[model samples]
Target: MAQLSTEVYWHSTEPTEVGPPLDGDASCDVCIVGAGYTGLWAAHFLKQAEPGMSVRVVEAKFAGEGASGMNAGFVQMTAGKVLRRMLWYYGAEKAGGVYRAVARSILEIGRFCRQNGIDAQYENTGILQVATDTKQLARLELQIKRAQRAGVTSFRLLDREQAQERIGSPTVLGALKVSGALLNPYRLVRGLARVVQEQGVLLHEQTPAQTIEKVDGKWRITTPHGTITANEVIVATEAMQGAFPELYARQMPVWNYLLVTEPLTDEQLGRVPWPGREGVANSLSFSTAARLTADNRVLWAGGLWYMFGNRDTDPRHRRNDDAFDKLGASFREFFPQWRDVRFSHGNGGLISWSHSFIPQFGRTDSGMVYGHGYTGSGIAASHTGGKILRDLVLRRKTEFTELAFVTVNQPKFLPAPFGDKGGEFFIWRQRVGDRLPLLLPYKSALAPNRFFARRTGSPERATAGRSSD
Candidate 1:
C-alpha cells in the first residue's frame, strides 16, 4: 500500500562515493562495463590474477547505485552448486563438473573476503530449507532424493521443534541447513571495490555506456561523455545491462525488497539460535533472514512480489515504503518477538535470466564475455561467474574454466517483444508463493498454496522464490 523507493534506503556510511561523470577517453587491456557486483568484482579478480593487467570499470551511476548495492544480502548459498540441477538436466559427470565449479566459487568468495581482511563476517553456517505443506515437502523430498543421487550431503532434515530451535522460528516444519555465509552487500561491494581500486583498477562511476561496438581493431564502449577502448569488454550488468538491449532479451528483471530492523540487542537476538551470523532461508521460495553488519543489524529480506507492477516511467523498485512492513511480517512469523521490531525499509533491483533459471557466463563474441543472470542470488555465483569470465578472457581452457557456463544458456524462455509488459506475472507468483507457505504453516497445510501453482509459467516463477532481502 505504500511506495517502495530504493534510492532513499541506499545511502550508507562507507567508502567515499566517486563523484562527477566520465569524460575523456580511457584505454585499458580489459574494460568492464557496469559497476554492479559482476563488473566491480570482475575488475577486482582480474587485478588479483594478473597484477599488471590494465583494467577500467565504467558505471552508469555510482558504484552502489545499481542492483549491486541495492540487494537483500542473502547470498542465498543453500540450494547452491546448481550443478546438481544441471545434472538433473544434463548428465552425471557434466553436472558434477558444474557442481564442483560452483562449490569452488563459494569457497573462493569466502577466501577473497578473508584474504583481503574485508571483515565481511562470513558465517559458514548451513542453509535452512523448510517445507510448510505436503506438496512442498514432497518437492523438498524429491530434491533430497535428487541431491542424494548427486552425492550432495549438505541437506539435512530437522523436525518442527529442531527447526524452530535451530532457526528461532516457530512456523517451520523442518529445515535443511548448509555451510554458507552472509554480509552487508553494500559493505561487501564497497569494501571489495575500495580494496580493488587501491590495487590500481580504474573505476569510473556515473558514466553510462551509451553504445558498445567493435571498432577497427578492438572493442570500444562509448559513454555519454567519453569512450573506452580495450582488447576485451566484459558486460556484467545482469538484468540492468541496458547498453546492449539484446541482453534484455536474454534476461528478465525481477524486483525484491528488504527491511533492516532497529538493532536488536544481544538479549533480543538470544531468541534466534542461528548464530555465526549465518543467513537463514525458509522452505518456501526466497524467504530469508540474516544477522549482518558489525552493529548487529537483523536484516530481514523477502518478496518477489512487484509492488509496482504497472507503472511505466518509474521502475518497480523504490525505497522506504509500507511494503517493508509486510516483508518484516516474515520475521515476526519466525521470531514473534521481533514483530514489534522497528525497521528501516530497503529496496533492491535484480537483472536475471530466469527464463533459463541459470547464471549465464562466457564469451558472447570475440574478446567480449558476458556474466549475468544470477537472478537474485548473485552473492556467491557472481564471484564464480567473474572468475570463469576472467579465465575465458585469458584463454584458459581447463575443465573447471571451460565447463563453468556452457549449457545453462539454452531452454530459456524470452517473453515476446521488447520490454514485455508481462514482467509482473513473475512477481505475482513469488508473492503468492511466499505468503502461501505461511498461510498454510504445516506440511499438510500447504494444499491451498499449490492450487495456484497450476498457473505459473512466467519468468518470475524461477526467482519468485523468497527474496535475498
Candidate 2:
C-alpha cells in the first residue's frame, strides 16, 4: 500500500517560489520574524498606514510553512471560553469590544481577498458546531446563552431536525450555527506574501532568526548568513516563539492533525445533502472540523492534539498514523453511508497554546513586541492580532491596544520539565475525556464543567469548544 501523503492539501495545490535568504547586514524601520499570517498581515497594514516605513520580513522557511498553510481553514469567531473570562477580567464593556474586533476580522479577511483579487477559494460558509451527544447538546445550549450575554448575536441554536437538514450527520444531535468563512489557507498566505512584496516590503525566505539583541536603541536580529537591524522588531513566530527565553514559559506548542478525503462523486455526495458547504465541527474538547473543498473533497481535522516534550517541532510529527486511523474511524462513524471514502492527505501543524487559552500580545522590556498563543484558533484572530501589533509598534494608545489581550498580564505556564510534563498530562486527560462518552453510553443533560473558564477567574462556566483552523 502507498504511504499517506504528509503534505497538506492546501500547500500541495499551489506551490510558491521561495525567496532568497538574507545575504548580509540589513536595516529597516520594522523587522518581523515569521512570514506567516501575523507577519504578512502586519506588514500589509503597516505599509498601508505609513507607506514610507521600511518594513522587512524574515522567515525561518518559505511563507506559510507553519500553521498558516497547514490549518483546516475555518475562519471562525468562537474563542473557546476566553470571552467569558475576558468579561470578568476587563468588565463587560472592554470584553465585548474584544469579541467584536475578532468577529469583524472574519469579514475583513474576505474583503481583503476580494480587493486584492486573491483567488484563495474564499467562501463565507458559516460554521456549524454540532452536538454529537446529550452532554454536548447541553454544552451547546449553554454556550449560546453565554455568547449572547457576552454581546455575540451572530450565533443561533439549531435543533437536530434543522441541523440534519443542513448536513446529514447521524451523530449530530443539535448544532450552533455562527457566521464564519472557509478559504484555501495556503493560497491566502502565499497571495498575501506576494501582495506585501508588491508594496515594497522586503521579504527573505529560508532565513531563521538565530539571536536577537538590542544595541544602541536598535533591535538587531541575527540569521545564519545575515543580520537585520531595525528601530522596532515584532516576534510573530507563533508556536516557534519558544526559542525566546522570555516567551518560553508563556506558551506551549501543541500538534494539531488534519486529513482530506478523496473527492466524492456526485452520487456519493448526494448521500449527504450539504448544499451550503458550511464549516462544521462537533462539541468535543479537541473538536473535529469538516468542510468541502472546491474540488469536492472533504477536509476533516482535529480530535487528537499531541505535544512532544521540550516543545519540539520535528517534521516527523507532521504525520501520525494513530491520528489518521482515529480520524478515519470518526469519518465513518459520522457518515456511515460513505464508509468507504478514502483520505488523500494527512498532516499536522503546531498551535501555540497560552496558559490562559487566549492569544497574547505585548511588548517586552527590551522594546520587542510579540503576539502568539492562539491555542488552536488564529486564522481570523491573527488579523486582529496584526492590527494590535501595528498599534504597539506605532506606540499609539488606540482601541486595539486597550483590548483585553493587550492590556492584561498574560499568565505563564510552569517552567521547563514541569511545563512539558504538564502539557502531556493535559493532552492525555483530554483524550480520555473524548473516549469516556463511548465507554459509558449514558448521556447527561447537565452542562459539562468548564475548567478553563474557572481557571481564568470567571464565575460563569462558559462552554468548552475550541475551534481549529
Candidate 3:
C-alpha cells in the first residue's frame, strides 16, 4: 500500500501558469477579489456583457489555488440542498427558477469547455444520489416528490439492481439519477482565468485585497502589491470571505476531506465495471461522494468537519486522519470487491457554508456586490452566479437577479463562540443521529429551517424582495 499523499491530485493534471502581480496603484471599471471560480466566472461574464469595460481580478495566491482547484469536481445543480431549502423558505416558483438556472449552467460549462478547447476532461455523465438503507431511501423518495413539485423533470429513480449496475455498490439501496457532469476543476478554473485574460481582463496573482472601502463615490481596494480603485468591487472570495471583517458574519468556512485511490489495474477495474462512470453521492447531510478520475483512480470524498473558529483555513486543517479513516471504511463497505485497494492521496478543502444552507448573492450594505456560500457544491452554481453577478453589477432586472437567493436580508450565523459551539453541536448531533434509529423523529431539529420559519412567519416575510435593494 502506498502512503497517501496530501497534495491535491487535480493540480498535478496539468501545468499551472501564474500571472504577474499588480505593480502599483491602478484603476479599473470593476475589481473582483479572489480569482477562484466565482471571481473568474464573474469576470468572464462581465467582459462578455461589455467587452470594452476594464475588469481586474486580484488573487491572494494564483487563480484556482483555493477551493476552485481543491473541490470534488462535481458540476451539479442541486448544491447545498438549495432545491429543498429554497422550496422550504421561498415558493416553488422561485425554487424551480433557481434549479433551472443551475441546470442550464451545468450544460453551459460543458459547452464552454468544448468551445474554448480546454482539455478539462469534461464528461456529461449524470450524477446518482444513492441510498444505502431504508431510511436514506425514504429521504430520496421525499426529495423526488419535492423535485417533482418544483417542476424539475430531470430526476429519474433507479432501483437497487439498476443502481448497482452502474456503480456496483452493494450498499446502494436505490438512487436518483440527475443531470450533472464532472470535470477537472483545476483545469476548468485555470482555463477560465486564461479565457478571461484573453478577453482583456487583467488577472493579478499574489495580490491580496487587505482592505476595501468607499472613497470619492468609488470603491478602493488596498492590496499587498498595490492599491486598485474601481467603479465597482465584487467580493467573490467564497470560503475565504470570513477573512474580511466586513463579510465575516455572512458566511463560515467548514473543512471537508476526501481520499483518492491509486490507479486501478485492468483486473481491479473489471471488478467494478462502471461503464457510465457517473458520480455517486449518498443521501446524508454529512454525505460521501465517489467519482472515477480520468487516470482510473477512485476519488472518494465527503464527511463534514468544522473547526472552532468559523474562519479557520489553515494548511494544517487540510488533513484529517479520522475523517480519512471513516471514508476508507465507508468505501470498503460500499465496494467490498475493492476492499484491499489503497488510497494514494488524501486531502481536504474548505467550503463556504451559509446560515440558510443556500448561497447568498446580491449587494452588501456598503454598496459592494458579493456572492458566496455554496455550502459544498459550487462548480456549476458558480457559473450561474457569475451571470447573476453580471446582471447585479450592470443593474439589470433579469430573471437571474430576481431569484430568492439574490436577496439582501440573508440569514446569518450566530456571532463568535456561540456560533462555533452550535456548529460543533450540529455535527455531533448529526453523526449521532445517523447511528441511532431512535433519533429519527428529532432529525428535522438539526436544520435551522423551523426556527427561521417561526421567526419570519412566511417565505415572503423571510425573503422580502426580488430586487437586491
Candidate 4:
C-alpha cells in the first residue's frame, strides 16, 4: 500500500485557484462567512437574484478547503440517515415536501454544472444503500415503507441477489436504491467559486472573520487584514459554528475518515459488478460508503467517527492511522476480491450535528442569517439551504422559507461536559450497533436511551446520522 496521504483526495487531485485575502476595510450589501458549498451557493443565488447588490464571501482558508472538499462526494437527496424520523417529526406532508425539494436540488446542481461548463465528473449513477445483516435489512425495509407513506416513491428496495448484481458486495443482504448523483466535490466548489466571482461577487480567501458585531444597525465582520460592513451576514461556516458562543450549543463537530484506493486496472475493476458506479453505503450507525472516482479509484470512507470535547478544528485531526487501518480492513471484508487493492490517499474532516439530526435555518435577533447542521448529508441539501438562506436574508416568505427546516424551531444540544459525555456515549453506542449480534451481550439499549434523553434537549429518540460527503 502507498503511504497514507493526509490531504483530501478530491482537493489533492485538483487544487483550486484562490484569491488574496480581504484588504483593508470594505462594505457590501451582503457578506457571507465561509466559502464552502453553503456560502458559495448563497453568493451564487444572491448575485443571480440581485445583480446590482454588492455581495462578498470571506473565507478563513481557500474555498472548498473545509468539508466541502473533503467529503465523500455522494450528491444525495435524503437529508439525513433516516426518513421515518423526518416524517414522524414534521408530518408526512412536510417531510414529503422537504424530500422533493432536496431531489430537485440534486437535479439543479447537475444543471448548474452543465450550464457553467464545469466538468466535475458528475454522474447520475444513483445511491445504493446496502444492508449487510438481517438487522440492517429490517431497517432498510422500514425506511422503504416510511418513504412510501411519505409519498416518496423514488426509493426502491432490492434483495440480496439484485443488490449483488449492482455492486457485487457479498455481505449485502439487501439494498435501498435511490436517485442521486456522484461528482468530484472539489471541482464542483472550485467551479462554483469561479462562476460566482465572474458574476461580480467579491470572494476573499484567507480572510478569517475573527469577530462579528453590529455597528449602527449594520453587521460588521472583522478579519485579520480588514473589516467588512454589510447590511446582512450569512454564517455558513458549518462545523466551525462551534467557535461562536451564540451557536456553540447548536452543533457538535465529529471527524469522519476516508481512504481512496489506487486506480484499478480494467481486469481488476471487472471483478466487481458496479457497472452503474452507484455510491454504496452500508446500513451501519457509522456507515461504510464507497464511490468510484473518474479514474476508477475506489473512495472508501466511514466506519470510525471521532469527536473531541470543545469541538476541536485542528488539521491534525485529519490524520488517524488507526481509522485508516480500520477502513482498509472493512474494505477487504466487503470486497475480498479486491483484497490486493492498494490505497493512494487517506483523510478526514469535521461534520456538524444538531440534536435533531437535521439542518437548521433561521435568523438571530442580532440579524444574522444562518443555515447548518446537515449531520453527514449536505452536498445536495446545502443547495436547498442556499435558497433558504437567500430567502431569510432577503426577508422573503417564499416556499423555501416555509419549509419545515426553516419554519421549525430546532432543539438545542446539551451544553459543556454533559454534551461531550453524550457524544462519547453516542459514539460507543454506534460502535456497538455496528457489531450488533456479535456484541449483543455487551450492549445496553436502555442506558444509552436514558443517557441521550438527559443529554439532548429534544424529546425525540436519538438516531444514528451520518456526516455529509
Query: The CA-based lDDT of model 1 is what?
Result: 0.62
Which residue pairs in candidate 3 have backbone atoms (N, alpha carbon, C) closer than 3 angstroms, thus clashing? none
Total clashing residue pairs per candidate?
A: 25, 0, 0, 5
Off by over 4 Å in 3: 79-82, 438-469
Query: What digit string (tens of lDDT, one per residue) describes model 4 on residues 1-469?
Result: 3487776788867856679999899999999999999999999888878899999999998999999988989898663356766776788888878887888898899999999998889998878888787666555545656776777644454556667888998887766677789999999999999999999999999999998988899999999998899999999999999777678888889999999998999999999999789999987878889999999999998886798666678988888888888899999999999999999899888898877777889987677888899888899989999999988888888999988888776888788788888888988987987776632321112132232233234332222222121
* lDDT scores in order: 0.62, 0.83, 0.82, 0.82
Better of 1 and 3 by TM-score: 3
Q: What is the C-alpha lDDT profile of model 1 across 340-431, one tens digit per residue?
A: 66665466454464554567776654446788777667777777677777777787776646563655444444444424555555556655
lDDT of 2 by residue, 1-469 (tens): 1467886789878967999999899999999999999999999989988999999999998999999999989897654545556666667676677778887899899999999999889999888888888766656655655666666644455566667878898878777677789999999999999999999999999999999889999999999978899999999999999898877887898888888988999999999979789988888778888999999999988887887677888889988888888888888898888887888889889999988777889988777899998888899989999999999999989989988889877888898799899888888897788667544332224422332222223232122232221
Q: Model 3 over residues 131-243: C-alpha lDDT tens digits?
A: 78666765665675677678764445566666788788878776667878999999999999999999999999989899999999999999878899999999999988977
Off by over 4 Å in 1: 1-13, 19-21, 76-85, 271-276, 286-293, 307-316, 320-322, 365-367, 411-423, 426-469
Best of the two (1, 2) by TM-score: 2
**TM-score for each model:** 0.82, 0.92, 0.91, 0.92
